[model samples]
Target: MELRQLRYFVAIVDHGSLSRAARVLHIAQPALTQQVQQLEEELGAQLLHRSAQGVMSTDAGKTFYEHAQAILKQVEDARSAVAQSSDKPAGTVALGIPQSVSSALALPLLTAVREAYPEITLQLTEELSGTLIEQLKSGRINLAVLFDDGQLGAFASMPLVEEEMMFITRAGSQFAPKKKSIPLSRAVELPLILPGLQHGVRPRIENIVRAEGLSIGNVIDINSVAILKSALLADLGATILPVAPLLSEIEHGQMTAYPITGASISRTVTLCSSRNIPLTNAGHAVQRLVVSVASRLCVSGYWLGAKSLAKSESA
Candidate 1:
């Protein structure tokens, strides 16, 4: 089958509807359907189960989707590899960053990369850590800053820092900071607003709480960090978060924070890339800059409640 046919099939699977995929591909719906039919005929398999709602990939379609994505990625990488042969690293580099890390590092990292590698185009994606990891595996992103719970052995990871999660609330609320540290048991008992289980930090906290033989109290689930902060300011409930996300609020006296005590609830941040896929020169440059910038931020105390993870300690 032609590469165009593969592209059409992949798009159909990704969007889950022929008309929607056709819209995204900017091609006529009939043409998209024709291409998909041609691919199915060539493969002698029904690729999708079409319905009014959307299309669901058949088992074979799922398998082909994975290979098609990899093939497309390799083709793109070949283009980037050749483009990086210049005196300076020059090409597009896609980097994924989780919401928590993006709060503190996104701006500074973007600025640093722009200043240092003007020719290397940077495409940054801010997403949940789990989503970022999935994208990394799918070859959608070249590199990512992810939370290391010591289970990501499949990736090439460089430990960046261990950031302490803190108890946070509105500055003048009843749950306002009363001490420099609050016990994990007590922290869980507070009226809490937290992200859903799909978020990286939420599951980590849940597991830690479970290990402590404690249950969270009065939780209000929120997925958006901005909305979470808004809920905090409205005196809705307290939250446990890394200081990086709410640093400006604490500094400006809009919120109060206390380090977690009784239990160590922290996440080890790491720079991760796929062990199976090699990075282009631009990708490597972006990874180095991320580590450098993160170190500088932690050392300067700009990334509060973070301790740098020495390079020798990377896994």
Candidate 2:
């Protein structure tokens, strides 16, 4: 019921033991246990499953934990926003980046944030676009660079870039396309390694193919960008993705990126934040920096096949 009770419950869930949480919180074990009991009584549901080894969240507790974390983060953000100075904002800002976009934008954003806001702590999480959306909704991350999948009504977004998807394969692989680009029909016929349906790119590709009455024939589902790249290098199969993730390999002649012709196979990348959640000063600063970095990269031709939608500005 109380903020302290929420904190105590969260701590217990995190440490998975009452005693450990008590030690970390510098409170008596009995007091912590009592607080958790009070919280459970007020909520009218058992929140934790106690065992000899440790404690675990029940189904109700799991749901409550997500809400509690979001509430706590919002409270912290409120405090930070009220106390932050306009000239030197100081707080922690968590930003989620999709794996494909991270290769081009992560380091640059990090450097820009560090140089401009030394006092602000920047936490970068690289995840699938689906996972990033979930994290943003749950308040685990303050901002996200996500692909616009026509399902972004819940978030306030700023257009960053429109990235072209390419069909990629190992340079010397037998399956490599001879031309600079290939039709969607021809590309899908190759043994393709792609992410599952939940990923941003896979669904877009599927939708476009379906519109043309084309179905992907041979396919392997791979979610990890690292493993996907490995599969391409080992010639397991080709993949259709943005060129950024494999830019280095393509430039080195280890991989070939062929633009997917006969289709507008592209995704618009956006800087997204939850519509219901107001950003802290640090979060706002980082959001601006992200847009700036993306614009700079696109203008400098560093982020290949990306057209900037936002104008360049100083972070």
Candidate 3:
């Protein structure tokens, strides 16, 4: 019913115990419990269930907790908007990135942010695109680099780059690299290790393979990028992926990377944010820096098989 009630309810959910929450809020246990009871009565929903260990939110409580967090974040943003000086924006900006993208952009992005916006605290999370999307919708992350498969209607997105997927194998193997590219038929003939259908890249690869009228045989499903790379290094099977994660190996001759020619399977990387959540000054700064850094990497040849998306193409 009141802002303080919302705060108390959130604190209780976060600490998972009324007594712990009361201690954190510097209020009596009975007072905190009363506020939560009042909130539940006002909302006409039983929010939490108590247990010997601590407490757990009911399904309804979980949903309400998400909304409560978003509300509190908006309030904080509003206060910062009015109170902070114009010349220096100070706050935390959380950015989510997939593992493959993080291999290329993480350190560089961190350095750039540290130099340009020293007052802004940046939190970087490396997660799959699907996880990142959920986090974005729940207001856990301010921005993310996600693979675009035409499913992001709830977010505003800017096309960062279109990356060609490479068919990688151990160096000095039978599929020795001669040309810069290989046909889809040849790529499929080899034993393949790839991500499952749940992965963002897998569906794109499947669509391209299906369009080419080819079938993948002797396939191995690997979800973790580290394990997949290890499989390739151990001469297990060839895999198709962006080259960013393989740069070190390719340069060291530990592996060979060739473009998949006939299918030309690729994924477009998009910088995305929730359409309902307006960007703060810090968010805007980070977004701009990401675009700039990505463009520089692509243009300077640091990132292979990557084409910088024109500004005109971004939504």
Candidate 4:
């Protein structure tokens, strides 16, 4: 119920033992146990499962822990925002980047943030686009680079770039497209390795294929970028995705990216933040920096097959 209780609960969960948390907090073990008991009673749920070794969070506790962490982060951000100067905003800003986007944008954005906002701590989380959406909605992350799937009306969004999907395969593989670009119908006929329906790009690909009276017949579902790359190298199957994820491989001549010709197979990359959660000064600074970085990357051709979207297209 209290801020101290939340802090204590988090500490206990992190340390995985009441005694260890008590030692870290410099509080008595009995008092720490009492605080947890009071919180559990108030919530009407047994948050932690006790054992002789230590303790573990129950299902209810796992859910509550996520909310507790978010609330604590907001509280810290509030304090920092009020005390920070406009010229040098100082606070922790959590930014989420999807795995594919991170391949091209993560390091550049991190370097930019460090150079420009030395006082602001930037925490970057590289996750699946689906997971990033949930984290952004829950206030776990301040901003995220997400693919615009026409269902992001609930969030404040700024279109960054439109990335063209490419049919990718290993350089010497039998499935490699001979031409500069392959038609969507021909590309889908290959033994394709693709993410499942939950992935942002997969649904788009499916819809496009469906509209063209085509269907992907043979496929292998893979979600991890590293594993997917290995599969491509091993000649498991070709995949249709933005070039960013396999940029290095393509550049090094280990992989080939053939643009889908028959249809406009692309996804808009958007910078999104929860409309309900107001950003801190540091968050705002990072948000602007992200847009700037994306533009620069597009202009310099550092991000392949990406076209920068005009500011007027923001949602």
Candidate 5:
């Protein structure tokens, strides 16, 4: 079908009415209606119907709309690629990041992409692991950095970095501020908040606590790592979270990370893209930035206590 016709069809679907889409497109309503009718005829299905309300898609229309949106996006990307100068990826790269991943990686990734690939536009969607997995399958994202590493049967993934998880508490708390990093025995005393049970993190935490045969008197469950950080900063709870998740706040002294010495647990973060399709240049550039920056940030924060101690001893 003609690109213009597909564009008109998409516009009607978006605006939910002939008149509104016509106004948006700077076309007359009758012309817009005729274009949609033609598109439907070519497809051999009734694409939309009208009532006292605005237009809505039929089942076939909905099916076609999905493909149509993808086609239009591809067409736009092609046009941009042809028009732009060499050595630039002039299309949008949608990135899916879990919230915990974002707290660990967003700033450095964004900065590096801007510096390295100026023509590539990035759209970031942050959700938890489960939601991001669905989105990755649905083509909602071009690439993703995820905390979940196993049972990914179809996606192509690489070790972005393996972050050693840290058990953390607030500075003023009795648990964290001491001559040394808090040992595992003192872990159960403070109130605790952690990412909800869906993540790989929670299972490892449960394993650790059980293995130690330690029980916490006050525990909180949260879905977002940012909320976990907020809770820790406020001294509301302690968290056993990934170093990447707490890197920024830990550096600023808003929170503290004590290495989990009684037991060792680390979550492997993966850079994933569609297995069937290799990443475009733009996509790979984004992936590179995220992997590089995440490693630097986490590595720097990983030795935080030791770094502080060395500095103090030297001083």
Candidate 6:
């Protein structure tokens, strides 16, 4: 099968509908279907199964999916290598960013990449830290900005920045009412709308709370930052969030930022890529741009400390 057929199949998997994939690829739906079917037949397998809900991979389809994606990526990489001989970046770079990183770094990163590498296309996905890491292992994203959580052994990690999380409550709420800062112990005394134990942040937050012999109340165990933020906005309870997650609300006076006192809450955000995949010229360029923009943001805004900012400029 042709490389274009592989691309069409990948697009169909991404969009879950031939018509939708056709629209995205700017090809006629019938033509897209024909390409995919031809490719499937050539491989002697059914690459996709359709249902009322959407298209999904069969067992054989799943196996072919991995190999097909790798072939397409290698083809793109070959093109990129050739393009790099001319000192220009072109083609697409798949990026997976955690929601928190997207909040802080995505806009500046995208803007700079757009300005500097006009020919580059960025295919993007935003997910939780866990999901982003999984995608990295699966070769779905060329680069990812997410939490380390001590679980990224398959990838090389460059620490990007560390964000100090804050314990925030609704204005005038009984918990953390307009305090400049409160000890982690005091912050945990109130109802908590934090992530459940399975979340990377939950254990650390809970450890600090449990130490003071006071249990977290109203334990809502929220998973989504948006849901947690909404709970805080409604004065339901407090949640620990990095500066990025609540920056807009805090800036707009809809929410508050109460830095945890005595003991600070923080996490290291990292830039990671698969160790097995060689970094393409475009990937390196984008990584540099991400560091540059993040450093400027940190230095200009006083959002991160000097020690943490060291990695912002490094590869």
In model 6, which runs have C-alpha deviations exceeding 4 angstroms? 1-5, 14-47, 50-67, 196-200, 203-218, 302-307, 311-315
Best by TM-score: 4
Residues 10-54, candidate 2: write the lDDT tens digits. 999999999999999999999898999999999999999999989
- lDDT, candidate 6, equals 0.74
Tens digit per residue, CA lDDT, model 6, 23-119? 9999998888788788878889888998888788888877777777867776777678667743676777888876656777777778888998888
Tens digits of per-residue lDDT for model 4, 1-315: 999999999999999999999999999999999999999999999999999999999999999999999898889878888888877888999999988889899999899889988988999998888998989998989999888889999899999999999999999889977778889989888899998788888888998899999999999999999999999999989999999999999999999988788788999999999899889889888998899888888988999999999442110
Question: For candidate 4, what is the lDDT?
Answer: 0.91
Q: lDDT by residue for model 5 over 22-126, one digit each (tens)?
A: 999999998888888888788899999887799999999988887777667666655655665545665688888878667546666777778877788988888
Worst 10 residues of 6 by lDDT: 302-311
Residue 268, candidate 4: C-alpha displacement in angstroms: 0.4
Task: Name the lDDT value of residue 221 in candidate 6.
Answer: 81
Summing lDDT over every window of 10 consecutive residues in candidate 4, give the lowest-scoring window.
306-315
> Per-residue lDDT of 12-81 in model 1, one digit per residue for the tens?
8888899989999999999898888888999999999998899999999998897787678767777888
Off by over 4 Å in 3: 43-45, 170-181, 234-236, 249-254, 310-315
Score candidate 1 by TM-score against the native: 0.81
lDDT of each: 0.86, 0.91, 0.85, 0.91, 0.71, 0.74
Q: Rank the candidates by TM-score, best first.
A: 4, 2, 3, 1, 6, 5
> Which of the two, 2 or 5, has more TM-score?
2
- lDDT of model 4, residue 166: 90
Report RMSD for candidate 1: 4.4
Report clash pairs, candidate 6: none
